[model samples]
Target: MDAAESLRLAARSIRGHKLRAALTALGIVIGIAAVITFVTLGASVKAEVVGQFDDSPANRVFLVATPGDDGGPPAALSQPVFTEYDVGRIGEFEGVDRVVPRGTIATSALSRGGETVARDQVTATTPALFESVTFREGGAFADASSGEACPAEMAVTPSAAALFPGNLSVGDRVSITQRGNRTRNVTVVGVLADDAGLNPLAGFGSRPRFYLPTCAYDTVVTSPTTGTRQNVYPQVTVIAANPGDTAAVQTRVQDYLDTESDAAQLAPGSYEVSARTNEDIVERIENVVDRLTQFVTGIAVISLLVGAIGIANIMLVSVRERTKEIGIMKAVGATNRDVLQLFLVEALLLGVGGAVLGVPIGVAGGWVAVTYAELPLTLPLVWVGAAIGIGLVVGVVSGLYPAWSAARVDPIDALRYE
Candidate 1:
């Protein structure tokens, strides 16, 4: 038979046993859908997670003090803190352009226009931190001179600005009560863009944050450690003058922290200081996501194999049931090749049908998951194409033996069979 006639006959046979055809194709549908859904979701999650760190400047390096070999608790816990002395010396390092002290204090409450919101974070860093940050409203806090105190200025994140009855505007005064019971009033100078220079560690964007100048940080919040001075920083972010010099700068900073810094002299074996570039951290994170995606995709591939077996099983049964029909076709001068083509075409139709149904279902499933998780949606078009190809391969391979068996049937025995 010609290709078109073969297809017409195969389609007629499938339609004649609609329920059996549907059942036979179900495994392929599930397999393709599983592969597509996981791949799409994996890509989307990876994109969303990596995108958060995109704003991090390539020249930036983060410094942290850990307790001995232990990484220590979150930066807020102040296991071994960097002091103002460390920040000043790091800034003077050969390739260091600037150093921003990353000190955060837990606040009891934030008050704006008589409305109160509870338990948020207020971070203190230098005005230089905002150099590349985009603001949604107003502008960066006025640069505080070296000798003068910071100008009671603060910047609020968009989430923070909307915490009150009415959205806070530039120049609005707000009171922040720190966990230490110290209350400081500061004017809002800027509001950060929703996606601009976000803290990657902040789980979702809903948490409110207020930024203050490092000079004013001590006046508002107490140090997390009792004996440590208020000037002690939980962490420090360093910007290298050039991206290529980042490694040299990191080495110099670590060497100084280990040998010359006060924390080094005081704690010695009890604490360790480490400086790492943004690129290093980001690469580590990407590696983890890639491994997870590969692992899940492997699981999906096994399901596809199961689908291939299902196709093979159903095709064998199909060959047995169509024995009489095959004999009549052969009696009418049909060649073995024609009979094989007809059976193969039927399997292909089933596989293609499942693929067509599966792709949309998988995409819809991925979209729903990402939407519910509030993550960026990414469609893995490559996986979609692969899924289609996989279906076709499964059809041909699974139907091969069955088609051969049907073609080998003798006309005399088939004709006499009930």
Candidate 2:
């Protein structure tokens, strides 16, 4: 018989024993569904993380401070104190475009009406930092062009502005109190948009936040020991001249800091200066996702193995029950290859049926899980294809021994027994 005839016979046999066929296919359905669901959820989480990184500044590099050996704060003498002057010096580097110093302090805002909003995260940065962010209200960081000792001007997030008494509008003035009762009256020159893409403290739950020019921030906040106001920024963001030059610039910046005269004054390894690019962050996140996916996929593979064993068991039972029919076919005209192909087609049909049913179920389950987790919804097409292919392979391999046994049956003995 031709291959088409063999396939038709296989279908007829499957339909004839509907219960057995369904039982055989149940294993395959469960395995395929498990694999698809895990793989889809993993892909969605990875996509969400990568999307957040993509939303950040592209060509920017971050300079972060690492703790000292004892796990306490770095020794004061060894501390790499970053000031506005250091920002200017870093900006003078070959591939450096702009340098923005960043510092944060917990402060309370006292509205002009004497009402206070406390526990606000106040950031000190330059107007250049505003270039990368969106503003829901007003313009860029209020320019500190007045040359006054402290230009009391700031920008506030919508959430932060709501904390102040009265309608917080642009051009309003509020008093900010930092540690040690240091206070400064500032004008709200701008309001940050709600969707300010990746801020440093985004991982921390939502809190009131505002931005002030570095100069203004230094004036309102003073060092505990110095008793004099100085620009003490904890982190410095270096914007590379070109996106493609970030890596090279990062290297140069690191080398300069490590070997620079002022930096050399600190003890070796007293404090470590690390630079991270957007790509670096994204790569780390993807690596973590890949490891997690592999772990979950390993469990899914176990399910597939179980399904394969179940398929083999069912196919073996089918072979024994159909022995008389097999003998008759052999006696009439069927060759060993024909008997083998017939049984194999039956297994393939089971696999195809499981794949058709399981894929949709897995997709629907994945969608619900991702939605509940608040992750980006992503369809893993590659994993879907893989699931189907795995199902077919499992079916073929499971039917192999049974098919072989059927093909090798002695026609004369089988007919006499019947």
Candidate 3:
């Protein structure tokens, strides 16, 4: 018999035993579905994380202060903290476009009636900060007018505005109480839209942040030891002159910090300066997602192995039950290759049928899981093709032993048996 004739006979045999064929393909269907679901969801998660990073300014770099050996805040008096002067020096470096110093103060916001609204961390920063960070609904940073000693203008987050009795808007008054029972009433210059997805601070339970001019922040919140106003920045953000200059700018900034005058005041190894771009963070997240995808997919491979074994077992039974039929085919001028092809084609059909049902189920399962987890839906076509290919291979390999056994039966002995 030719190849086509063998395939036709295989299809007829499978149709005659519909229930048995379906049962044998069940393992394959489950295995493929599991693999596709996990792989697709993994891809979606990675994409969501990377997309968040992409939304932020790519050319901006963050510089954070290192803690002391005891895990406490670095000695404020001994260790050098970034200030406006330091920001100026950093900005002077080649390829540096701008530098914004950020200071954090813990305070409770109050209404005009003296009712407490919420306790949150307020950031004291330069107007240059508006160059990098995006606001949901605002124009520019409130001008702290050049030569002004202290400006009471402030920008409050949407979450912070919601805490007030009525809707908060520009030109409103927000009273805040700082440490040492000092209270300051500041004018609302702008309302900051929530960019939680793109802001790293959102991860640390950052309550509604209120932005204040650095000058006003110093007047209300001063250092205890000095008893004088000073800029004690815990973090500084740097914007590169151009997108392509980010790497060079980062290196120059780190090198400048090492040799800057501020370094001379610090004890050796008491503090360190580090800088990172958004791309660095994205790469780290991708690495984590890739490892997780591989681990879960490994488990799915075990399921496919079990399905392959089931296919082999069922093919063996089929060979035993059709022993007389095989002998009759051989007597009728069917070669061993023809008999082998017949069994192999039947196994292939089982795999193809299972994949047809499994792929859609896998897509649906991935969609539901990703939606529950609040991740973007990203279907990976490459993985889908791979899953189908795997099913086909498993089906063919599973039939090899049974096909060989059926082909080896002698024509004479088989024809005499009942």
**Every candidate's lDDT:** 0.78, 0.74, 0.73
Off by over 4 Å in 3: 64-89, 101-126, 132-154, 157-168, 171-188, 193-236, 256-274, 412-418
RMSD of 1: 5.1
Q: Write the per-residue lDDT of candidate 2 for residues 84-192, one digit (tens) a residue.
A: 4456678898888888777766575455656766665587777887876777888666555346565677887777788766557788878878767788788888887
TM-score of each: 0.76, 0.74, 0.73
Give the alpha carbon lDDT tens digit for every residue of 18-60 in model 3: 9999988888888888888999899998888677777777787
Best by lDDT: 1
Model 1 steric clash pairs: none
Q: What TM-score does model 2 achieve against the real structure? A: 0.74
lDDT of 1 by residue, 1-418 (tens): 6899999999999999999899878888888888888888889987876776665667777776656544323233334357777777788889888888767766888888678888667887778777778888988887765667668888888877887777888989988898678898899999988734454533334567788877666532233333456476757788899989988888888888777775465444656666767665556566767777889878977887888888888999999988999999999998999999999989888887888788888899889888987888999999888878888888898889999999999998988767
- Between prediction 1 and prediction 3, which has the larger lDDT? 1
User: What C-alpha RMSD separates each model from the true structure?
Assistant: 5.1, 6.1, 6.3
258: Cα error in model 3, Å: 6.6
The window of 10 residues in a row where model 3 has the poorest summed lDDT is: 71-80
lDDT of 3: 0.73
Comparison by TM-score, 2 against 3, better one: 2
Q: Estimate candidate 1's alpha-carbon lDDT, on a 0 to 1 scale.
A: 0.78
Distance from true location, Cα of 250 in model 3, Å: 2.0
